[model samples]
Target: MRDAEISSWRQWVTGLMVAGLVIGTAGGPLVGQETDDAEEGPQQVIIERTPVQLRDPKTYSVSLSLEPIREIDLVAVADGVTGAVQVQLGGAASRQAEAVRLDSAERQLELERAKALFRVAQAEQRATSGGDANAVEAAEGRLEAARAELRLAEHRLDATVVRFPFDGKVMGVHVVPGQFVRAGQPLVTLADTSKMRVAIPVDRTAVNEGDTVDIKIETDTVQAKVETIVPLKAEFEPLRELFVSVATAVLVLENGDGKLKAGQTVFADMIPRQPVMEVPTSTLANMEEGGRKVQVIRDGFVRDIPVKLLGQVGEEHVFVSGRFSAADELVLSSSEVLLDGARAVPAGAEIPTEEDEGAGPAGRRRGSRF
Candidate 1:
């Protein structure tokens, strides 16, 4: 029963195929009368005008961003017991406050001794000071020393407290309260996620200095200009010349409402010198037997145009053909049963809508495997 239905469909298309030939020859000078009918007519899929692309669209890329660029490390300046950690909202103490607090007790005694010596030097008589200039020297020296000692004592006392250097969240807490810490020990690690960067592995063969590139992280798309192409050679992959393949480029990222994250995997939309076309694989269509073809609808006729397949492009076949234009009309097959040069009517043609696709901007139809 299915076979009979198939035969009947074929018979109907055969009749339509003959009608299409007659319709095509109506305006032009008739030549089919003399031409051999044995030659298969141009398979009817759809007739479309190839778009005249000025600058063909292209997509190429390097690595988006791999890691954040601004990362900082916090370390303890001096060693001591952890004390008051700027527990107030206002001015916080310094990082080495713990060390200062530990030595504050001894500093107070030294400050007192310095003050007494300063007083003794100031009491020297002018006559004695003039006759013995050494007295003046001793007084000034002692006074300076006393002032320094006082400052030291104050600093030591202040060391017991820790304060924030800048407004930021605590990334980590290494030593807790009452925990003994040593000098130069790591306290917390901080990373500025305000803006991220992508390290792109550039191909010296494909990229040059100062070439702009695009990176797409999920739905977010951003542009990155050429900062610097770092020329590096590895022991595993040595450079054949002074500069080998694979350069590192710092790609500045646009936060775009902070949608992008550090260490997130993203694809780079690297623009190449060569223009390229981005089309869906479904847009690539193969005819009954005349290789691959795409249906182009123009002037109310769907004509099958030949397309040269150019391998796979993200699971879609990229076709190279002179018939395809950026603004040409792409006719999706009518119920997947359309034939070459099939007579078709555009839907909603005379509706007088605000927007019009006309003969261009219609997407393509990928052919099914016969």
Candidate 2:
């Protein structure tokens, strides 16, 4: 019975071993299938980034104009050409003395006698050699004095008519024809507005002495050449405290229409082009760190690049300089999801810095917010 039992145990043990080998062989396909599924796992989708070239918006402002104003200078003496006043202007110095007269006709006769005596002295010197050189010199001196007196009389007679000094307009007429005016009296004041000038404030860096600017007066566009760029004085009211100052620039422009009057406020915009690095307004972003910045996409990761902004252009943004290239991808819109190392989709399936035109990339589409 022991022998039989041993033989049966050996047969059953052999049968169990065979069954285990078949079962292990059958499980190989399931293990291979599980390995394949793990290798091909679900993929994550990301947004896209792109680079573009657009016109730069860097603005340099200068004032339209600061003009020179002229007031009238009145003629002080108007002796002749009185009354029948046609409201004219002349140089004050050219006018004869007003209310000036020779004191007496007897005084004139005394002058005449002095002249006769001088002539007699001349003849006496010729006739007798009484060391008359002194007498002759004295006579000549006396004759000159008489002639001066006559000239004074003549000036008094001619002082009645007034003449114009230069081309100017008369502001007012004080007296009519036959109006007797005294010396040092007021005739009419005159003003000169023939040559008009303007003063405009500008950035010291934007303009130099010879820079030309396009100026517009209402509808008229004119080219105004810079005559001077002078440092504004400390006496200026508003600019007194500002250390970075507004400079005075003188420009010569056409005022033919005379539309631009003195003291009239002018609104103007200036576009000056200097060499500066520029990026599209959309390329820049506001940072949480309290300053402006840009998104720098590199190696399929996002980077926040710091930037310094200068000003703006027509519906565009402005910056002085930056390290980014035109081919670098930037995020246009705001997103809390964007950060350093964030995964991004590109415009094209071919992942490169630059995107080819008119093709759909991995995640970029027209409907998606930029």
Candidate 3:
């Protein structure tokens, strides 16, 4: 009876061991499935960013005060001038000088004759030293006096007729014709508006001396070329401090059409022609070294593209350029943390097209708000 009981106990133990092996094998598939699911990672969706070719011009709206190319103050150059307005151009007042005793042309002829006679006498004196040298010297002295008188007469004639110095409009008339005026008296104020200039504050980096700009005065718009950019002087520091938002650059543009007038308020717009890439300002990430960078979604992976900051465009957009093609996909808004080599799937977000933004054929569009 003892031997049978021991044999039964051993069989019971073998049965328990077999059952444990089967249970362990069945749990293997379930644990493996859970591990596979964890490895699949969380759901992530990447949206396509609207890739804009910043080929359009970056424009700025700035109020400018127009100024003339030159402002001249015409004054009476001679004494005893008639204030009687003679040749009036652009509403300026001027008058011919009082009548001269001798005609300028006649005086010129007389001076030439006197010079010729003096030369002949000088030759004669040289040829015969003793032939009444004192008398010849006296004749030459009289001829010299006549020549001096001719010059004075010619000068007086010139002083009679007032000539306008440049093509411009007269801003003020200080004297009238027929009125006797003294030397150094103010005549008229002239402004050369054929070409106008405006001191436009601009970003020193964005503009150049030769760039072209559009100037709008009242209802007229004209193309003007940048003539020069005046450097900010210490004298203007007070003005700069007052206008803290404005730059110190002074833009001088050519307005040859005279459409722009001095003291007239105008709007100056500068457009750039070079091509660039436009991106939302939010996508930019600050670099550790310096400058800015952005994350690009390409081939289901993220790439950190180094971009050049080309200034801001619209309210929320910025112009940037570097290693990017028109077809390259940029991540606009992403659900997952943007990481290098991270797997991503496009969320099928609609990207804005050029047509929606009213971008012209050349991608021309309006610029910033301020």
Model 1: per-residue Cα lDDT at residue 155: 69
Report the C-alpha lDDT of model 3 over 1-370, residue by residue, as the tens digit.
1459647744754453333210001112211224455443233332434343434222222345777778877667666535345434455332332212112354456556666766666665565555687866776676566667656655655655556666667776677645566667766677777677666555566667788766666677766666666665443333232122334444465666555567887653321223356667888888777877777644433566777665565566666656665555665555445554343332333323346646553223211110
lDDT of each: 0.47, 0.47, 0.53
- Backbone collision count in every prediction? 33, 22, 12
Compare candidates 2 and 3 on lDDT and give the better one.
Answer: 3
Kindly list the per-residue Cα lDDT of model 1 for residues 1-370, writing each as its tens digit. 1459647754754554444322122222122232445343322222222332323422222233445546555555567666434332212234332211232345456667666765664564433566667877776676677667667756655544444444333445555556677877765545455566765555557666667777666666666666677754242132122123455666666454655566677663232223333334565676666676666554444456666543243443343443544454554223344444433443323321113443342222212111
* Candidate 2, superposed: residue stretches over 4 Å from native: 1-72, 78-82, 88-131, 150-162, 168-186, 189-194, 216-219, 233-236, 240-243, 254-370
At residue 224, give the lDDT of candidate 2. 70
Q: Which ten residues in a row have the lowest lDDT in candidate 3?
A: 21-30
Q: Any runs in candidate 1 off by more than 4 Å, and if so which?
A: 1-66, 85-131, 155-169, 205-211, 233-244, 267-370
Q: Write one digit per residue (lDDT tens) for candidate 2, span 1-370.
A: 1459647744754553333210001112211124455443212233334453323333233344435344443443433335345443333222322322212344456556656765665565565555668776776665666667666655544444444454444545566566565656666655343444556656677778888887565466666778898876433323322214457777765445555444444434322233234455776768776767777554344567666654454355454344555556555443234544443443233332224423544223312212
TM-score of each: 0.44, 0.39, 0.42
- How much is the lDDT of residue 368 in candidate 2? 27
